[model samples]
Target: MIEWFTAVQVIVALLAGLICLVLGFIGKQPNDLTLGSIVLVELLLIAQLVVTIVAPTVGNEPSGSLAEFYIYLISALLLPVAGAFWALIERSRWSTVVLGVVGLAVAVMLYRMGQIWFVQGTP
Candidate 1:
């Protein structure tokens, strides 16, 4: 649960959200650029997940409840995938809106994960 990496994830999520919202406002469906951005964010999240799992083994366990942290982690990991799938199926501007909303949600979840891991203080 590296704090800086978590911050990066949050930033990326917000950027993706903004991009998607702008595209939606302009009546554009999810395009390669939007989807690619989401994918990049997703990959960062996967790396975060790996670090979260490996950190505990290396004496960096989170202070918060492991179960709660895992819940947030899993949700953060899945949101982009689900949103992308929905966007592909719907093929409308609203699909981009859906992605935008999902991105925002992911950002919030990442922040929560950080609170769970760092703000609570090391155990």
Candidate 2:
């Protein structure tokens, strides 16, 4: 995994999360702008997933233990997609809450990813 990409994702996730909360406070539903932000975050995550899959095979040093990387990758990749679907199912405050949760999770995963990447060469 590219540490820089993971860092960028984390920042993006945090900004999205804050937006979700603000939108939720202003209104109980997500507006078009909120939806657009969600889509952008999803695209970035998909890109991260693609790069992660290719990194190991392309001579990049493996980040952390392989098992850990895969676990984080799958969960990080799933959260936003699932949240977006769930958000559409209910156009209420809860939907925005879900988005916040997903964003927070993505940020946490990015931190974990960084830890894994940096710890690989340690004894």
Off by over 4 Å in 1: 121-123
Q: Per-residue CA lDDT of candidate 2, range 1-123, in tens?
A: 777787788898888888887877766686676666667778887897788778878887564686787788788878888888888888898788778777778878877877886665545
Worst lDDT 10-window in candidate 2: 114-123
Worst 10-residue lDDT window for candidate 1 reads: 114-123
**Per-residue lDDT of candidate 1, residues 43-123 (tens digit):** 999999889889999998888888999998998889999999998898999999888888889999999998998777645
Provide the overall lDDT of each model, using Cα atoms, as 2-decimal numbers.
Answer: 0.89, 0.78
TM-score of 1: 0.95
RMSD of every prediction: 1.6, 1.9
Model 2 lDDT, full chain set: 0.78
What would the TM-scores of all predictions be? 0.95, 0.86
Per-residue lDDT, model 2, residue 81, is 85
